[model samples]
Target: MNLEPMAGFLTFWAWWVAALVLAAVETVAPGAFMLWLGIAAGLTGFVTLATGLGWEGQLAVFAILAIVSVLWGRKWAKRHQGSGPSSVSRRADQLPGRAVVLVEPILHGTGRAELDDTVWLVTGPDAPAGTVMRIVRTEGATLIVEHIG
Candidate 1:
């Protein structure tokens, strides 16, 4: 209820400590979201220490920095999209342009194929088993393929 005794510990260094803890947790967690939050906390700590902002002002600065950092991070991610691993999450996205033999004949633009030792539902023109095909794209869980030669 009473936070007066903790006032001494709630100075600018407190933000730096919080930032370090958040960054450490981010390393052990999923997604890169917390990294940005930690950056905001660190920035807030720096500003608070330099300008001696009050607790309310420090919190306002943290919120603003967090929002701006997340927005910038999202924009940066979009700009760098597809530049990293092809299959960042969806395993099927890694199959495009990969050649695979038809495990089951495609009938009515749908069939099955094997890739990386995994059988997958595929959509393409009619092709018999043993027909080599190149995966072109994907719709849902189905791999879109085209006959190769």
Candidate 2:
């Protein structure tokens, strides 16, 4: 088989395609790792287009960019940590310090409280319905609370 055509196939479009694939994978199993690699691949495509580098040079550039981009992404993530969706699915984490009304009487140190649209299981001293309580902490899915005047 002639190797000339195959050598010409490693073009900017190839890199861009690789970048798209990496980005797609990131979407499927996201943890920010593949996203940075996708960015590196996309940038490498632009560099390849501008420099007309050979396969070896393109590979070298891609390696450097991938390493640098991943490290930079890690640093950027660290700096901006907790800036997005502070609690997201972990609603318990966001419950601390929030006051809620008891919907069900705390008959034996456990009751239901209503906050917004969801009902949360609370653990605290026995209290009657309509009592106000402040969340102190969480144990698993249960919120530990304290009564307030």
Q: Scored by CA lDDT, what does every candidate get?
A: 0.84, 0.88
Candidate 2 lDDT, 20-91, residue by residue in tens: 999999988868899999999999988888777888999999999999999999989989886556666777
Model 2 residue 112 CA deviation in Å: 3.3
Regions more than 4 Å wrong, model 2: 1-35, 45-52, 80-86
Candidate 1 at 7: error in angstroms?
A: 9.1
Once superposed on the true structure, which residue ranges of model 1 sit more than 4 Å away at CA? 1-10, 81-85, 88-149
| Shift of residue 94 alpha carbon in model 1, Å | 6.8
Candidate 2 TM-score versus the reference:
0.63
When summed lDDT is taken over every stretch of 10 residues in candidate 1, the lowest stretch is 3-12
